[model samples]
Target: MGTEGGHGHAIDTSIPSAARMYDWLLGGELNFEADRKACEDLLEIAPSSRELALNNRWFLERVVRFLARERGITQFVDHGSGLPTRPNVHQVAQEVHQGARVAYIDIDPIVIAHGRTSLEVNSGTRFIEASMTDTGRIVEQASKGGFIDFGRPVAALYVSVIHCLKDREEPAAMIRRMREHLAPGSYLVICQLVSDEERVRREVTELMDQGTDGHWGRVREKHDVRRYFDGLSVLAPYLGDVTHWRPDSDLRRPQKSLEWVEFGGVARIR
Candidate 1:
């Protein structure tokens, strides 16, 4: 178990990982029985877990397209990017502009394995095995490899993964650091599990914390997430449930779950 071809690492199937559980929710097979059981328990809490995952994924695709086509952003850094789902960042961006380059970062060994294999043939893309907070290493590796140019207007994405970060980890501060690293006119795409219900927040946070062996962050309120976008120019309609943020034709029907939602938006770094 080591980093080889950027895919080698010890995978402990005994515990469920947030990335693997997320893959299971999305109907992917990159998960183990532990992950499946965790999802089952998660569904009992958030009955619409699967739907929420799908909506969040759709939001990701739409935002990437907007960045590539309308915003003319050619580079992307997908922080905490999980298992390779269909229409990945590079696929969405490159579809708009074939020259688009993307660097996917994640700490999950399974994600690294799948991402490296799926992206092996794509010269314009690369995967880095590292925590999302290791911004310096990520930028250095991405720039040195020519997979991303820090000098250009790159989009740094933290979609649906911030909930995995504890407060002490300072997710907001991490975003600020990344904001400083990016060039002017760069963008930040963020969203995470947010709930208005205190019960839902507490229970889900506790459940995930236990399920992932304390590798989980607390579920936060919308205002807590809002602080992450403070001082930045939020895109049209402002920060809200991602399902309502620039939805394409395919997302005409909104998700009806009120227990929680992926809350946040895209912001431009001035």
Candidate 2:
């Protein structure tokens, strides 16, 4: 468990945080009453939210295991990595290759606090506090002490966090910047909240924005997420509900709801 972060901000229990809300949805106890209430409101808008979160989490694990075990990807950079959970990226990757390295990046105060406390024993992993879109600093810090080798292949994972960016924040541009830092054999694992129903998208986006005080981005359509992977070589089962993204054979996942989904897939940087 090794950890370091750029920020030392104290956790504010009065306001809602996307990371904490997500923790609450995952049945984790690192959240405050505010986050729990916010999740309750979110459930009203999208009844399948808990199911959606679980599926997205499952997708993350499935992809990480597949990349480390099957593709021989030994290093992983997890952007916007929320509160620590079971079978984290480092855990999954290390299972395949004991020396595998992982860097967890997130700007949330609570995430940084809990991460530093809980992940202090793993020497091969790091928890960095910074905006995932902060390409320059993230690239710099993740590279320190040979934490991650830019010369070697790596997996840059956005997972379900890109939706936290506003349009002006240019999530795609951030991806492009990170892609520029990876080797030809490296890969990008991305996914975000998307919906086919316009109403579902509008309402959820609005509610989250208000709940987090504009710390959230809009829910987009499938095509919107597709554009993020413009030049990357997408793996099979390209861009759809994450629930169906190469599901595990031994494990049964929850079914996807019609209103919205966490959508995206794995893509090679080349």
Candidate 3:
């Protein structure tokens, strides 16, 4: 198998990383012990986090298919692309459009390591080790690397990742910068971990911040997430629970609850 870097950095298993924790929650084997402990602590506070993560992942797959197949978008940039699991962004998008190009960006060492290995063999994709906060460089690199054509309609995805931004990081502004770079026909797909309960939001955010050793972002309300799409046109089933966004008939929900659900949608640039 093609590979990039392999565990180049010292594996700091003392503290958790949102990426690894998420991998664990999704039943992936890329996580470390710190990730498991952090996830356990989160479960104590919000028992539905694992379920929410799974649903959000499914939501991402749905958006990729919709954009590649239904909307005919061929270029994609998945911000904060964690460790690659089954049916990754490029895999899903390329399934519908073989010419699809995907650029996965993330600063986490593990993600970068795994991304390099998982994507090196895919001709239409590449992995960039960068922070979402560095939108200018990301845009420049993506354009110069020949993976993305800003002149064409590209689907930029921020699935379940915005919460990793602290308020000072200006996640919205970064997205706005990216939006300004896209063509009118392009789409921006954004979703984040959300909760209507203030207590749930506060505790989980605080705990995660601690669990990750301050490498965490705060969770925002559902409305705040919607604000990112203010000028765009949202598609059908607008901004409901992600599981219901475009669920497959075979994927049965064994239980239903909305305490912590994926809430976001696809919006076309106007």
Task: Give all candidates' CA lDDT scores.
Answer: 0.85, 0.84, 0.80
Stretches of candidate 3 exceeding 4 Å from the true structure: 1-10
Model 3 lDDT per residue over 1-270, tens place: 001112336557677888888889889898788779888988887887877877788788888998888889999988888889789988999899888899888887877877898786898997877887788888888988566889989888888888888888877888899999899889988888788999888998899778776777776899889888887889888886777887877785422456676678888997
Weakest ten-residue segment in model 3 by summed lDDT: 1-10
lDDT of 1 by residue, 2-52 (tens): 011112367788888888888888888888999899889988988878888
Better of 1 and 3 by lDDT: 1
Error of 3 at 160 (Å): 0.2
The estimated TM-scores of all candidates read: 0.95, 0.95, 0.94
Model 1 weakest 10-residue run by lDDT: 1-10
Q: What is the lDDT, from 0 to 100, of the residue 251 in candidate 3?
A: 89
Q: Judge candidate 3 at residue 46 and give its lDDT.
A: 80
Judge candidate 1 against the unseen true structure and give its global Cα lDDT, from 0 to 1.
Answer: 0.85
Worst 10-residue lDDT window for candidate 2 reads: 1-10
State the local distance difference test value for candidate 3. Answer: 0.80
Instruction: Give one digit per residue, the lDDT tens place, for model 2 in 134-210.
Output: 88998899899888999999999998888888899988899889999999889999888888888889998898888
